[model samples]
Target: MAANVEDFKKRLDEQDLHIRESWVAAMKARIVRGELIKCQRGEGVNHYKHCRDLAEMYTGMIRENKVKGYKIIDTE
Candidate 1:
């Protein structure tokens, strides 16, 4: 029983790490995309839209992972 518990804990830790990595990648993508629009003017509307889209995508991914029985640790 102890071994099984340890194995389960390890798997949960791995899944949490994977989720963290995915979040980092998503954040980097958002930053890179945002930087590409730095020289443009009158892009407030587009920028807001882009950010919203990325936010939605990131949230969707987290929700899907949760539905798959994975717990995302609140590292905040």
Candidate 2:
């Protein structure tokens, strides 16, 4: 019984770590996305030129799976 309880506690701790890691990744992604948006917020046609670096950073982050469920739409 004691071993079972320890196992359950260990599993719960692992789950907590997983949840924290996911949350941290999401928060970091949100900041990165916000920076990219801010860079392009009102640039219009010039956004491509002005925001290229941020866009590249965002794309790299996504490609590296630093965020979930996002992908680069185009490189043109």
Candidate 3:
């Protein structure tokens, strides 16, 4: 029983890590696709907004994946 519990916990941790990596990958893809605008100005409010939007999208993706029982592991 203890071993099964440990395994479950490890799986959960791995899933969380996978989700985070997925978020990073999604954000990178969005940047590559020009969905996220480049900040010509310095690190201003627009830059912050862009980053926040990317993060929110990532979070949404994570939630969606979890609901589907899919682990989002990053290959790159």
Candidate 4:
């Protein structure tokens, strides 16, 4: 029963991760398509300074959905 519950929880987490990943992809697409400006109008390395908001949001999402490393076992 505990294994079943763990599997169910893992499934739910995977679904949430998928939804978050989709959102991130859409945001990236908009930025790439120029529909959403990700940085200020400038021509220097400092241009990234204007993108702190977007960067922070992206980082937050990634950090929130981060998964721990797990080893895969091969049973032949």
lDDT minimum window of 10 residues, candidate 3: 32-41
Task: Show where candidate 4 strays beyond 4 Å.
Answer: 35-76
User: What are the Cα lDDT values of the candidates?
Assistant: 0.62, 0.76, 0.61, 0.60
Q: Score residue 29 of candidate 2 by CA lDDT.
A: 65
lDDT of candidate 3 over 1-76, digit per residue (tens): 9999999999999888877866776666556335434442444666666566755665565454432234457799
Which portions of model 3 show Cα errors greater than 4 Å? 35-76
Candidate 4 whole-model C-alpha lDDT, 0 to 1 = 0.60
Writing each residue's lDDT as its tens digit, candidate 2 over 1-76 gives 9999999899888777766776787677678889889878878779999999889877876666453322247778
lDDT order, best first, reads 2, 1, 3, 4
Candidate 2, lDDT over the whole model: 0.76
TM-score of each: 0.52, 0.68, 0.43, 0.42
Instruction: Give the number of the best model, judged by TM-score.
Output: 2
| Top-down TM-score ranking | 2, 1, 3, 4
* Candidate 1 per-residue C-alpha lDDT over 9-56 given as tens digits, one digit per residue, 9 for 90 to 100: 999899988778767766665664455456233467675655666555
Query: How many steric clashes between backbone atoms does each model show?
Result: 0, 0, 0, 0
